[model samples]
Target: MYQVYYTRDKAGRITQKLETIEGITHSIDYSYDLAGRLIEVKQDGTVTETYQYDANGNRLNNAQYSKCTTK
Candidate 1:
């Protein structure tokens, strides 16, 4: 299981996140434009993905991937 702690600004905008489990910690940071639109998402000290949106707040594009591992 994973747990995340989120930090928000005065306007209740999520600015950062911290994930921790079994004594290991990871961080995610968020960036926004002047219009309060989410522009980027960075995780574990890396720029993992980015997001783009239309003027109507509809998601235009998102960069993401997934992988699986087996023991």
Candidate 2:
């Protein structure tokens, strides 16, 4: 069985997650902007994802995946 652990902020938001499997450990970290919007994601201390939002809180694009279009 694998083991997983999480670290949270004062507000109970998960700030970091650690997992161990087969004697290998991996970590993921979460970051938020001032407005509490998720802005970045890191895996093993390397940035693997990024996010951008519009003024109205609409997701504009995701750096790791695809872009969003407005109709």
Instruction: Write down the TM-score of every candidate.
Output: 0.73, 0.85
Q: How much lDDT does candidate 2 score?
A: 0.89
Per-model root-mean-square deviation over C-alphas: 3.5, 8.1
In model 2, pairs of residues that clash are none
lDDT of 1 by residue, 1-71 (tens): 67889999877999899998887898989988777888888877677778888988877998863433499
Task: Kindly report which residue pairs in candidate 1 clash with one another.
Answer: none
Question: What would the per-residue lDDT of candidate 2 be over residues 1-71, giving only the tens digit for each residue?
Answer: 69999999987889999999988999999999988888999888788889999999998988883334499
For model 1, state the Cα shift of residue 46 in Å.
0.7
Model 2 poorest ten-residue lDDT run? 60-69
| lDDT values for all models | 0.82, 0.89
Error of 2 at 6 (Å): 0.7
Candidate 2 residue runs with Cα over 4 Å from true position: 65-71
